[model samples]
Target: MRITNRMLSNNAIRNINRNLENMARAQEQMSSGKRVNRPSDDPIVVARILAFKTSIAANDQYQKNMEDAKGWVDASESALGMATSTLQRARELAVYGANGTMPKESMQALGKEVDQLIDEMKQIANTSYGGRYLFGGSRTTEAPFVDNTGNDKNVKPVIYNGNEANLEWEIAPQVKITVNENGQQIFVDAIDTNTGNKIGIFDLLKKLSNALNSGDYSGVEDTLSQFDQAIDHILDIRASLGAMSNRLEMSLSRLGDTQISLTQTMSKLEDVDLAKATIEYKNYENVYLASLATSAKALQPSLIDYLS
Candidate 1:
């Protein structure tokens, strides 16, 4: 078929448009600093970048959870430490009150201090973090222990109002950890093997108080072993919390490593090298200019151009 002037001009225009499109794409890549601006740029690479981004987001959430759990663990450890100190002080007073030669007035004074320690211990049991009770298990919104010993020191004054449920936090995919201790286990229901009696920390304190106020030397002396046991129990709780804190730190480290790897991989798939992109854009621009020059020269002059 014979080629007409109109067909030659159309062909020249089409070639120039293709060259201009390539230059625009290179310029966009340079400006955005990304190789895969759209899926059409490289569909497989774009899909891989998306998957990496999703994994990074999940790791971010896991890190946040570990941070929150760490706070709870630290708070619990501090409160339990305070409780152990309070118990030690109370035990020292018990040793003093156990003296048979001490007068009833001195015994009463020591009993008053023990009573104060009871109040302090109760406060420790009701410790809170971020306005939530740390020892209350799943019942974090309420106080775990209530005082009922008002006028009668002989009565068991502390009652546990919290449940035995464990509060769990997810620090990784399908990995959950208990973040709270049951108030009932820590504060109440401690069994005394010798007497087959359920003597908790508060029960021991109330008995010691009554013994001191009435100058019962034997009762005061009996509490020494129980006090030692209670102190050991608090230490056990603190040890458990410490172990959890260490595990959370390890989990956070793993998440940080995973995030760094994902970010590097995503950069390889999605980010553009500035130097390479600039060179590519310059090459495309030169080709576009050359195409325009060639098209201008090859297209035959029309009747309209002659008239002008």
Candidate 2:
């Protein structure tokens, strides 16, 4: 092999550039605090990091869904609880109105109070959370119960405007749960077997109020059993809401655990050790300097250099 100054200088330059590239990589790792700055750095690790990040993002979405479901269930439970209390009050009023000896004026006053309670029950049935009705099934924007009775006594006092569709939320991968109860089911399905008419809580309240105002003691007495049935229905719905809330809480806990694990795994794959990166950079810099020094001594000076 013909050894020459040109060859020696070229080799030295190439070695120096390689060392500079190594040092630059180490410096980048230190500055960015990441081992894989680009895909070329470590393709396998980069792929793994991307997969983990996608999983983490999905977990976050599931957690959010569970939170939304929890809010809906909580609001529904609170509303149902209020409904039960309101029904109990109506039942007490019915008991009082059933006494035939009560004066007509006293019965009419009690009927007025019962009417007010009916309005309160409507409010409870149309309860909302975050501007969406909780008991309206999938029809969340509209009130579930409305006062349709005006001068026409033939029509039912309360009309249900919601549907029977169940609203579901995905709290985990491939796992969905119902978060809403059908308002129609809860408020409009109870039938008065005696009269062969649907006498759900609202209608039951209406009949009781009409009986008291008209001094019909028998009609008021008839409502006591219906009120009991309505209260029981509301309690059953509330129990289901409680179960849904528990499931949502469990889903949230699982999502939190999965998120932590994904983050740790991602950190292991991509995060750089600052101390190790710094040491590697220093080593590369020292080797580059040493190579430069040796090249200066070994490569003979050109004649043009001396003339200059």
TM-score of every model versus the real structure: 0.94, 0.93
Kindly list the per-residue Cα lDDT of model 2 for residues 78-126, writing each as its tens digit: 8889888989999999999999899999999999999999889889989
Model 2 residue 212 lDDT score: 92
Candidate 1 deviant stretches above 4 angstroms: 149-153, 191-193, 302-308
Query: Tens digit of lDDT per residue, candidate 1, span 209-277?
Result: 999999999999999998999889889989999998998988888789888988998998889998998
Against the reference, the lDDT scores of all candidates come to 0.89, 0.87
What's model 2's overall lDDT?
Answer: 0.87
TM-score of 1: 0.94
Tell me the lDDT of model 2 at 76. 88
In candidate 1, which residue pairs get closer than 3 Å at backbone N, Cα or C atoms, i.e. clash?
A: none
The C-alpha RMSD of each candidate to the native structure, in angstroms, is 1.9, 2.0
